[model samples]
Target chain A: MPIPLIQLAGVSKQYGDVRAVDDVTLELEPGEFFALLGPSGCGKTSLMRLVAGFETPDAGRVLIDGRDMQGVPPYRRPVNMMFQSYALFPHMSVERNIAFGLVQQGMAKGYIATRVAEMLRLVKLEGYGARRPEQLSGGQKQRVALARALAPRPKLLLLDEPLAALDRKLREETQFELMQVQRDLGIAFMLVTHDQDEAMAMAQRIALMRSGRIEQIGDARAIYERPASLFAAEFVGEINLFEGEVVQSGEGKFAIVQGGGRIALADDTPLPGPVRIAVRPERMVMSHLRAGSYAEFAGVIADMVWLGDLTVWRVRLSDGRLIRISRSNADAANAAFSRGDQVFVGFEAQSARMLLS
Target chain B: MSLVKKTRGVGDGGLAANLGRRLVLIVPYAWLILFFAIPFLIVVKISISVQRDGRPPYEPVFELADGFIGAWESVQKFSMESYAAIYADRIYGDAYISSVWIAALATLCTLLIGYPLALAMARAPRRWRSLLIVLAVAPFWTSFLIRIYAWIVILKDEGLLNHALISTGLISEPIHIYATQGAVLIGIVYSYLPFMILPLYNALEKQDTALVEAALDLGATPFAAFRQITWPLSMRGVIAGCLLVFIPAVGEYVIPDLLGSDEVLMIGRSLWDEFSTARNWPGAAAVATVLLVLLLVPIVAYQRSHLQTHGAAR
Candidate 1:
């Protein structure tokens, strides 16, 4: 669809004996906001650099709009990168910084002036043309860097942890602003971040990375609801895992927990002895009474935390197993259980997914 | 009311202390005026003093009634003769031109070799950078005369270069490289090469390499990035290196004396001849004055520009 604005095939980059990015193959549709999410040194930034032509892959190829970027340098490539530090030239004024790429491309002086003015307005930094980067606040500097990266109108824009430098509140505000700009321009934006919340908030789809390979790639809700692997589940969001073994294999398979507790599965998949079941905290329902409507286990409330709008309950099952459950403020009074109180935790069989470890 | 009275008394004491501090600051100012400023005035006084024809280069019993008149008449009357004589002589004219040309050429050569070396030093690995920097400046630590003498051995007709070339079959005979202008230029460039390298290395090394990358990311080619960002940003070092090499090269005497033939007569040698052989103090002073005047403008300009740039950056 839309010719897949950027295509990366077998893009592996090595640093000496260490492979920073291993055999990454992915594509982004035009105007899609794609995020490569991982922890630090997990090769997310390395992947972005490869796409921006800053680092050449030791093997494999990076293609932008069906053209192989073999010998092409960063300047010649039709991609622009916004560095994490903003990397604004301190010697130049705000206007000059934004106009740098246009000038380099040999655009007419008048046209550059007009385009730079328009960009400054787009970023809502109008009338700040004469101020240097040091004179601006953190958010202003971020806007200037964004304007500069967008000034050349490249086919693909790479953002390397663009909001990492901003404060929490400012970062949240700028995330929406960045999303708006990407939508307005209709350009493919590839964002690299170790921040899961940031990725979920901005990107249409995410490529979650680990070590040197893509762990999983899917839409935000799919990745969160159904992670294909343990690493993907742990990386994307908080999940309570119960280590167990498959005792029966059929349409309604069952798993025996470590301490003789049983969990029924919805679908039967061929599996060896050891397996793990992952379930979201909110999916597990907690009640003071034994409802007896679904798979249930008796537990004691170990700890409780009130997080303004939601209450968190940590419950230890009868078999010495601990599970976390979150209840919204609207449902806080339903159980009314505090620490050291007895409760029952239950979940639907279809809600929990089994992950092979 | 009591506290106010005490504070007022303290304020009076503070005023007295401030006055004492101001007086203490004037001490260096007075010393500078007496030692530096007054000596320059004395030189002006002596230069304008008239010398009688039969007297021992001094005027005694001169009329104070004609005070300003005598100073003017003496400057006009007692000689532009030295100036005229120096310019009329072909040897002095030739020496002046040769010295300027040689220094300019040496400065150019130093820039050509030192710029790239400095860039390499700047981009070198951090662990290897210190070693490279020390190697670039190690030659300056050795004795200057020994370095010049070493050059003499290397540039001789049957010396290292010629011998190497002849043995390699690149030359049929030992070329006459010694006691020539080319030899002098080699000696000048070699001796002062460190002076060029150190400043340029400092400037290039201090540059933030991110700026270069930023330029390239903005669509500038590698060479364009270097020309637009690296070169202009390192200009302070270039200017410093040029001045360091050019100033001393202009007045160089030893290298020319040891390395060049009799055909190369430099201003330094001319000044030496006027003072030692010709016994012409006024003529040598005149030559010294001219050289000093020629140098003072550029040095002042360089210092002013340097200060202006630093001030602007701040």
Candidate 2:
């Protein structure tokens, strides 16, 4: 709606025989925080580099603000990247580092000074103008890198795992700070991270990548609740998978599993042959007594892990199929199901969706 | 506390015993004091000693009773006379000036050539980097005199360059370039080029190329990235290369002697003439002292500046 601040259309990059980024086509709306989430070596960083003009697309085109980026070097592009290592100039002070881009752009000295001061204040590092990068803590260095990348006021800002170097607590704190900055500036931010929780916490939209291709792209909740592929469902969060065959596909769809018998599902799509049903672990209900439901199975608790907030129980059904169920600690405590205890696992028919692939 | 006492007693009985410890350290310490410090003191004493008429400025003559006068008269009577004599000789003066200018020019030439080579060295492929480095430094393993002499074969009147040019019909006659200022400069630059390159290669090699890309990303052109980021970051290498070239270039006598004509005088030749031909020990010492002073000032300045910049960065 806002003219899509950054557009990567069929962009692909190849290193020798290996395709690092394969036919990636995506858009980033203005003022939106977008994330590219994947494990290491999945081309998320390569995608960010392509957008930043660090690496030229081997085949397709990268467009920023509707202008083609062919033959345009990084400095001329209206995009800035914050490297994962922070890449702060070790020789320069905080103020100088922030002012580097402005100085290179030939802004007047006084204006550069004023803008740098304002940016330092924006990142809440106003008084640390004279300190070098090594003198600052990890969080402060991250802020300096952010301030430096933002000082130029590029149309799109690229962050490559900005919080990967920070400790756990610091990373959490800085994630909120980064989100606040992105929102306050109202600029499009493309963040690359392998951490699912980090992506969910920060990005408005996420592109989950695997083996150089986008497995799925959607809002945080959609990607978590309804992944388009088995890879995306498993990668985003834990899910209990039930392998079965589509025995009947009409108004009431049913899947007959190998070990377990037939179970009625909500999906009515014409999926033929074999398919798998995916359900969130938390969506499952576990009890010692067999409750009347659309689908039910008796199983024994093989393992029980008591986290303070939640409890995870591994259930082995009578057909020798394993299913994981997560319940709140209060509920699990009241039930008091330990290992070797028999339990009944049941879920609503509408909750489990049949994945054709 | 008891354990500390026991260890101390053992240390005192073992390697820290007075005689054994003294025996262990005395050889090297005494060697250094005798060979290094005492020799330096002897040179200082001889530099200030007064000269009699017949001897070689080392006659044992004490005139101190006449007003604490031996060293004082040496100062007043000898009184920079050798300095005056050497200064009066226009050849020595011109040679000193030429030496400084030639050394400075050669250092500049070396930097201009070596920087790009070092850059190429730093950017070479991983497998080729070691080969390039070895090639850059391989000239050092060959004899220095041999290398200078090799230039003789290349730059002589009927040498390889002129012969090739003539055979190619580029020139009708051979050109005499060997005994000229150009020849000396070529020789000096060639001899010291590796010195310039090694330091620069070391410094440039240590640079994380990501910094250059960071500069380019921040809106610097390729050349601008090199100037603002690469060059300043490699200042340590530049200083080291300049020192490596300048110090030896100023005192170099072999290349000039072998490559240039007698008309081209340098401080090294002047010092050689004073000692060998002119047989003026005091005058040669005076010239050597002048050369020493000339060389010491920049070395001190360079060290100070290097320390200051390094300290600031730290």
Candidate 3:
């Protein structure tokens, strides 16, 4: 296999009493779009900083393109970072800011001008060359920042909460434009964001982190459908967890009983002792008549909210447990169930996954 | 009450705020007229008078005791002889040139020494910054004359500086540092260093360090980043500091009198001699007026340039 564009091996960093980045080993294929997804203070930004050479790992190594990057300053590194604050030079015009990195590389003035114009066109800001950063709007400033970071054509690019400053509509538009730019240039990108939706929408692969450790690393579907731990399960999306114990085991099938309800799985390997099953809110079906083919529970609609595209209902089960179920607005009959309506909540065996812890 | 309310529009702040705003503007103008403008006009009047053997030593340009017509006649008799005397003398020209040269040199020295010191203080850890500022201003706690006296003790031929140099074997004999132009320069720089540093520190401390990091991440070295970003951004402070040092140094009297040799004829020393030793009051007033006009050139230029930059920024 070809060498990975970026490789982090057992990297760790400590700040005073806090281990900002724990032992993390990761690799990204060339031209890959990856994300470090976590909440605030979860070390995602720190991990990006380590890769950018702003902070050296207290232990282990950072390798880029098969070369060890130790004792190298940020200026010599073959990577660039778009800071959260944009950090555009306030005194320089937009053309100067975009031409800064190329000038540092000692590119010719004529070529640098053409390159700056090309970058302005790429970011859809063609006629704003002479304006200072303070004169630009928030979204325009963000585009200028992106253009500046991409002007040098580094092997890898790092974005730290790049869209946190924009409004929702602008953020969505920028997200699509950013992905397009990354794809067009064929450069590897590593985005750091606390917004899970942004991470899922942009990154091809995501490394979900918690308490300075990578909880899971996979594509969005795997992380959402087959979460490794309870933290991973709850962090990605909304889910209904049923705590139970193993009551029966058979060939390629097993059953779990929780209070007045029972759940059966199709797995051949039987789990012992207490276990939990996690199912997404959209996976659970609600109907007036219970289907004989699925294991079901009797519940009453406790509360419901109607989102434009989807409707979510909180159902109170016979055991006094509240489980959330969501359905798309595609079906007209789905809106029939309102508060206090008696319904049967059922899930197919394949849709639920057993959690060990 | 209804008519008054109708007359007062929504945008207006009513009578109280208008009075308050007027007071804010009037107080400083009143102070200037009483303390500054009146005295300055009196000096101008004296600068145009004729020298005579009298209690005031100069013919009064205005005499209210002789009534309006008499005062008008005296005003018509105001002479331009003192100004002509200053223009004809080479000593006054040499003194003005040397004073300007010395002040310019001292301002340059302060800037060269103050820039790095201010940058270091700005880069220092946040907890130690207050202490550093306190230390920078600590010299002001002592009396100004006493501080100059202390410099004399250290810079004299057999002073502490020469003694330490001799003990370290750097020099075999005491050097003539006291009573020279170099001593005057040293005194000016030492006295005005805080003026240079305080404004620079204020400007540098408010800068966003993330810009420097962004420059480095874009492939610029630390020095290049400073040249491209930090220095240009702190120019306002540099100008303020230079003006603060240069203006005062040009008209300084006590330091030059105490530290400079007799050969270095500064305008401040010349003014002192004309007023006291030569007892030429009109000549002294003419010299002071010229000095004020000379200093006004830079201050007005700076103000116009400052307004232009601010206008562009807006």
Top model by lDDT, which number?
Answer: 3
Q: What tens digits encode model 1's per-residue C-alpha lDDT throughout B24-140? A: 999999998999677654433433343344433434322456688775665565546567776798887788788989998999999999999999998998899999988987987
- lDDT tens string, model 2, B66-86? 566565654464345667776
Ranking by lDDT, best first?
A: 3, 2, 1
Overlapping backbone residue pairs in candidate 2 total 0
- The CAPRI category of model 1 is acceptable
Q: What residue pairs clash in candidate 1, if any at all?
A: none
Candidate order by decreasing DockQ: 3, 2, 1
What digit string (tens of lDDT, one per residue) describes model 3 on residues B225-308?
Answer: 999999999988999999999998998899999888788778999999999998899999999999989998999999998998
B-chain TM-scores per prediction = 0.78, 0.82, 0.92
Per-residue lDDT over A229-273 for candidate 2, one digit per residue giving the tens place of the 0 to 100 score: 888888888898888787665657677755545677655555668
Candidate 2: pairs in clash: none
Across residues A1-357, which tens digit of lDDT does each residue of candidate 3 receive?
799999999999999999998999999999999999999999999999999888999998999998999999999999999999999999899999999999999999999999999999999999999999999999999999999999999999999999999999999999999999999999999999999999999999999999889999999999999998888899899999887666554544554546435556655635566777788999998899877566578899999999999999999998899999999999798869999999998777787877877
The most accurate candidate by DockQ is 3
In the order shown, the candidates' DockQ scores are 0.46, 0.58, 0.80
* Model 1: DockQ vs. true structure: 0.46
Docking class of 2: medium
lDDT of 2 at A279: 86
Model 1: per-residue Cα lDDT over A266-338, one tens digit each: 5555574787778888898787888875557788999988887888889998778788888787874745788
